[model samples]
Target: MDIREYRESDWNQVWTIIEKVFRAGETYAFSPEISELEARNVWIEMPKKTYVAIADDDEILGTYYIKPNQPDLGSHVCNCGYIVSESARGKGVASRLCKHSQQVAVELGFRAMQYNLVVSTNEGAIRLWIKLGFEVVGILPNAYKSKSAGYVDALVMYKELKT
Candidate 1:
């Protein structure tokens, strides 16, 4: 897979992925009925930069967004959220996106990356993140009200990007 910066033209395709991922109520914390306008704000407008992972023909198979974890005092640390199409899962898209996000964070001068509310029940993501060197720094009990399991814990994972 090839990772590249997102272009304005990519929003439609990116939304296709985002809609499916979010509506599934599995990975992200977004409401299933999240409007496109809100999605645009969250996935594109808010992020410092967004990326799309594509195939040779340039079909967007996965995507991620990176931004500062907080403004002002906490700006040195960044955060990222990722989504891989269901059809594209188990094919290394998430891994590639995470790696690309870390590299992009470094390029943007971020000292570390943190995932603030990773659902503990999301085993695949938890495993992938741990494999990518993120440590579980904290856990918020009953933080995520999963549609499937209701009130599951959320894990806070962090990785210092600079050496």
Candidate 2:
């Protein structure tokens, strides 16, 4: 598999991956009913950069986007969101996308990375992020409206990329 910058041609595949995850409403904060146009804006246009993980056969296995965590003074801290095709889960697609995102973050001059709304029930992602050097900086009680778990807690994770 290989990782590379996202291209317009990747949108359909990328959206398919994200749409299912978003519709699940278990991990990300996006609305389950989020429209394609809205998703396109959020996943592609708004982020500083977006990337995809492609398989040997050129299938898009996963995708991620990196952008400023906040505006102005807080811009040095970047934020990212990732999604792996359900079929690719447990194959390290998400992990690879995250690792690649960090390298891209530093190359983009970001000093740190933050994930503002990681649902606590997403153990796999939490474990991977911790393994990759991020820490739980804070927790928001009943912040995520999970489809299966009702209102669940959300975690704020952070990592310093450059001293």
Candidate 3:
């Protein structure tokens, strides 16, 4: 598999991956009823950069986007969101995308990375982020309205990319 910059052609496949995750309402903060145009704006247009992980056969396995965590003075700290196709989970697609995102972050002159709303019930993602050197810097109680778990806690994860 390979990770590369997202192209306009990747939108349909990228949306398919994110749509299911958004509709699940279990991890990301996006509304379950988020529209395609809105998703495109958030996932593609708004971010500083977007990427896709492609299989050897050229299938889009996963995607991620990196952008400033906040405006102006906080722009040195970047934020990212990731999604792996159901068929690609457990195959390290998310992990690879994350690692790639960090490299790209540094290349883009970001000093750190942060994830503002990681649903606490998502153990796999938490574990992977920790393994990749992010820490749970803060927790918001009952912040995520999970489809299966009701209002669950959300975590704020952060990592200093530069010393």
Please give each candidate's TM-score: 0.97, 0.98, 0.98
lDDT of each: 0.93, 0.94, 0.95
Q: Candidate 3's residue-wise lDDT over 1-163, tens digit each?
A: 9999999999889999999999999998889999999999999999999999999898999999999999999999999999999998998888899999999999999999999999999999999999999999999999999999999999999999963
Q: How accurate is candidate 3 locally (lDDT)?
A: 0.95
What TM-score does candidate 2 get on C-alpha atoms?
A: 0.98
- On lDDT, the stronger of 2 and 3 is 3
Residue-wise lDDT of candidate 2 within 15-88, one digit each (tens)? 99999999998988889999999999999999999999999999999999999999999999999999999999
* Model 3: residue 37 alpha-carbon error in angstroms: 0.5
Model 1: per-residue Cα lDDT at residue 161: 88
Candidate 3 ranges with C-alpha deviation above 4 Å: none
Q: Which residue pairs show collisions in model 3? A: none
lDDT for residue 7 in candidate 3, whole number 0-100: 99
lDDT of 1 at 65: 98
Clash pairs, candidate 2, are none
Report per-prediction Cα RMSD to one decimal: 0.9, 0.8, 0.8
Best by lDDT: 3
